[model samples]
Target: MKSPTQIINRELKAKKKCQGNPTKKYFKELIDYYINIKTLNEFCFAFLKIKITAKIAIFYFF
Candidate 1:
């Protein structure tokens, strides 16, 4: 199996090949976005939980 760094490098290379001008900053942005999503997933789950609970409460009252 490839190491995490190796996998990341491979992905960056692929992105560069597809885009034709990949920079180190581009890879950095990609990593940042990936991490941001992980953090955002928790927020999304909480939001969904509240939304579902609110819907259930509305149905119960109506």
Candidate 2:
């Protein structure tokens, strides 16, 4: 979790650079950051596949 002060400072910088409220832009950047982190995406995808596989197995067995 980001510290409040750190989050505030980043929002201030982003807002100044964008010359408006930064929430939307910040989220875009956040998504881009996550995409760039392939390991995290891979972990999430693997977990999701596991969950779906488990559900399918249960559906067929019961």
Candidate 3:
């Protein structure tokens, strides 16, 4: 038979292990999503800048 202290220690260890894993996975997914969105925003801004510059150059030269 297990002593009361041993049972409490086992329960505590189980709870600690459970608590550690889910938050790490959740934050990793959130970071990945943020990075993807940031990269997409940057790409869109660069494309617009290039397009506007080309239009202005064409208008001025022709």
- Best-performing candidate as measured by lDDT: 1
Ranking by lDDT: 1, 2, 3
Residues 1-62 of candidate 2: C-alpha lDDT, one tens digit per residue? 43446544754565476556344564454344334434665547545644564576468656
Q: What are the candidates' C-alpha RMSDs? A: 16.0, 12.9, 23.7
TM-score, predicted candidate 3 vs. hidden true structure:
0.37
Where's the lowest-lDDT run of ten residues in candidate 2?
29-38
lDDT of every model, 2 decimals: 0.52, 0.51, 0.48
lDDT of 1 at 28: 55
Clashing residue pairs in candidate 1 are: none
Task: Please list the residue runs of candidate 3 whose C-alpha ends up more than 4 Å from where it truly belongs after superposition.
Answer: 1-38
lDDT of 1 by residue, 1-62 (tens): 33457545855665675464444444454444344444565446535644564576468656
Question: Which of 1 and 3 is ahead in TM-score?
Answer: 3
Residue 41 of model 3 has an lDDT of: 57
Best-to-worst TM-score order: 2, 3, 1
Off by over 4 Å in 1: 1-38
Residue 43 C-alpha lDDT in model 2: 45
Count of backbone clashes, every candidate in sequence: 0, 0, 0
Question: Can you give the TM-score per candidate against the true fold?
Answer: 0.35, 0.37, 0.37
Task: Name the candidate, 1 or 2, with the larger lDDT value.
Answer: 1
